[model samples]
Target: MRLSRAFIRAVSSPATVAWRSAQSRIFCSSPSDYRKSQPSMLKHLTSKIKATGPVSVAEYMREVLTNPVTGYYVRNNMLGPDGDFITSPEISQVFGELLGVWIISEWMAAGRPKQLQLVELGPGNGSLAADVLRVFGQLQSVLGGASVSLHLMEVSPALSDFQAQTLTGGGSQKADCEEDPVYRHGTTAAGLPVSWYRCLEDVPAGFSIFVAHEFFDSLPVHKFQRTEKGWREVLVDVDPEDSGKLRFVVSPGPTLASATLVQANERRDHIEVCAEGGVIIQQLARRILNDGGAVLIMDYGHDGTKTDTFRGFKDHQLHDVLLSPGSADLTADVDFSFLRRMAGGGVACLGPVTQGLFLKNMGIDTRMQVLLRNCHDPSTRKQLINSYDMLTNPTKMGERFLFFSLLHPSRLAAPTKPHGLKLEKRSPVLLPVAGFTDLSFS
Candidate 1:
């Protein structure tokens, strides 16, 4: 379908949004030094390291990302062209549309559950959720009038406001939002009740279809660098030469916490592990195992191996990890192997498939053809084409990003295989899930 000017406005160009722009700066004061020009989180980290010694990469990421006042995510629009990076949903409507379709297909495959909790994690500006809602809203009859409760897990106040505005078509200035610290509930344009939570655990109990796009990578990971004697924990410490600056330093070797990596690592090799991610996957897997549902995670990461993928971004460009602290977005590769192991034998885990292959298998090419034919404007057509290339291009987000799905075995009639998860594995469950043709789940 051809998008109107308003739809175009809704899917705004990242370059035009001021909040996404790198030029936007947030200022703050620190407890240690009132006159320090650095961001408050930066000063806070420095003081923390000075007083408590260096911290693990996971601790550093947690503080920098969600640090109430000066954290990057809490205060900024970190998506789109103007932001540190542009996610697939922001790049084109096709991405979200296909995802929405996939959700519907899964729901249908599950015998059309009367009540489904459609949940999203870290919904940036709520664009993907909004698009998903839109698609589902249009297919009410086909869905047999299934009731969907939209739940968004977003800790950032600024991003939550944007999400509410996008989904509900109104700002969240109500008395309840201000009064409720733990949770705030609203309704979308379609009258579907929307609830916001600070974390995943707060979401109400039910069979859910969870979607986490680029969310896992943001979870903090502890980095371990192998040394001569043994693996040591990588810590962020204040630079001795320059007191105000921060640098990474290795802690004492033979770290017990990193003992798991002894066999996986070699001398001088670095490995990253996101214990938080594993905990979350375990929780989600348990929920899915207990209650019939599925979890889809799309992010950039490896198949559970050793690598120093932790990095930072500022103003749509790569930035030094230890330079400005919470002023920039810090992220690392999501180790899918860790997630798989976390799932254990409770749920069925699917592909760490490339985003490009998943999307193409899901029929992005056909969707693009439809849009291109409907779109007459040369400029819009060009924009759509470029977006298609960017999303599917191997040199771009295509190969870098992965599509991982976790399904409850009960969702299918028997233990049947789902698309993308069709590689050699212990489980013989395989089905032709749309968008995963010929792709090996291994």
Candidate 2:
């Protein structure tokens, strides 16, 4: 997008920079300041480290982001305009609408399965789910009145409450036991069955289309650095000089992860392995292979090309990751190459395609034009245009975010011909289906 003074001012804002930029640690305060500011979490971490020595970055992230009592995600409703960061779904209804269309499109290609469970991992505020559900309602006839249900995998009670309120209008009932597979249940405003789970494994197996937007990036990652001796795991340790804070330190010797996670042929001097993300991908792959469905993962990530992407965000500005505990959001860029490998050979993995290209292939431009044509309010129309720019502009979210998928192997195989019909050369699933193909749009 051409940068006007207004555009420059907007993108240069703390919120935008924090969400999209690659910045180094900005230590505005003492590393130990976290002890005074958020002592509950920081003290807990410092105490743990004092007792047990350095912890894995993965463990540190798990505690900081989802520590049940004091973690950021658990204690804060930190998303959207008024919070830590904003996501594409919050930027435009068109974002969610296009994805919703893709979900239904995939379902149709699967021959309208008897049961369709729309599963979302880390559904933030349920905005995406609401938009997808709306699209399903609009295409009821195309769905052939198929049994459709919404299954959400969320770990934050605060966010789940918000999601339940947003999607079901405060109608969901919490499960009696936290151990129950389904932790919550509700009927959407449109009367579709909706259920919530704390993990993907708890979601019942079915012909499900899994959607994860900006989800995998939050999974904890283990950082490693190569030394003359061998690869060593980088761990989070309480800085001896500043007992109130944390810092990264390399293991003195090889740790189990350093030995097991790093590939023998790996050439990078520095590497980060998200074993947790790999496990999730494996689960998704196994589900698609056995039960017949697909998985779509969208996030800001690298194709295993980036190193040292771990950082923190608070109120839309970069925060020193090591300085504070449980006071900001922590994340890293997902390594698509690792995920693809973990997916194994059974499922066909599609592009880690740029979000701009994927959405355009999914017909985002056409969708935008239609929305503009229907809306009459000047402010609303202008907002729609700006949102379009923000979402698709290459230098903005468009390039930073990407779309990747895992489909049942058969989805890409030659289509079986009906009784007397001729067999097409390309798989129907590859013909402009889900934007993985380069489809020409009018």
Top TM-score model: 2
The true-versus-predicted C-alpha distance at residue 128 of model 1, in Å, is 0.4
Return the TM-score for each candidate structure.
Answer: 0.84, 0.88
Model 2 poorest ten-residue lDDT run: 18-27
Residue-level lDDT tens digits of model 1 in 344-438? 88788887888887887777887787778778999999999999999999999989998888887765445333332222222222222454222
Q: What's the distance in Å from true for residue 107, model 2?
A: 0.9
Report how far residue 185 has shifted in candidate 1, in Å: 1.6
Q: What is the C-alpha lDDT of each candidate?
A: 0.72, 0.78
Q: How accurate is candidate 2 locally (lDDT)?
A: 0.78
lDDT of 2 by residue, 281-336 (tens): 88899899989888889998998788888888889998887766787899999999
